[model samples]
Target: MMPLSMVASGETVRLIAVRGGRGICFRLAELGLVPGATFQVIQGSGQGPLILAFGETRLALGRGMAHKIYVESFMRGGQECQNN
Candidate 1:
């Protein structure tokens, strides 16, 4: 598993785990970031907020918050990355 922040822009990734205190986890979960959730990284850089797309909703997650969320990036046709 890798930090959500490391995912490439425009790639769809599956949420694997969320690391942090209960408050953080609760906040993320409230935003629909629970484990097994799938979302596409709308935008990402080493700086600024990371934008994630879940269906029609878009959420801007701070870099620090994003780092605490781990994910598994998947390719087209729902194939997971073997190199991870």
Candidate 2:
């Protein structure tokens, strides 16, 4: 598994776990980042920030912050859900 920050542009991944204190964990959860949730890396600013989409919301996160969020890469057509 790679940290969410490591996800490349246009790549998709699944939320596996979060490594951080309760406050940071709660912050991520409130942003719709949770176990099993899938998201795509829309863009990554060279400095550190990344833009991601989960469900219908788009969020931007810094690399230092994203490193605390662990994720696993998912291939296209790996899993199907009623929603896209």
Winning candidate number (TM-score): 1
Task: Give TM-scores for every candidate, taking all chains together and pairing residue i with residue i.
Answer: 0.85, 0.81
* Candidate 1 wrong stretches, greater than 4 Å: 76-84
lDDT of each: 0.81, 0.77
Scored by lDDT, the top model is 1
Question: Which residue pairs collide, candidate 2?
Answer: none
Q: State the lDDT at 36 in candidate 2.
A: 76
- Candidate 1: count of backbone clashes, pairs at least 3 residues apart or interchain: 0
Q: What TM-score would you give candidate 2 relative to the actual structure?
A: 0.81
- Candidate 2, residue 24: the lDDT equals 79
Task: Give a tens-digit lDDT track for model 2, residues 42-74.
Answer: 995366689998778899888898887877777
Deviation in Å, model 2, residue 24 alpha carbon: 1.0
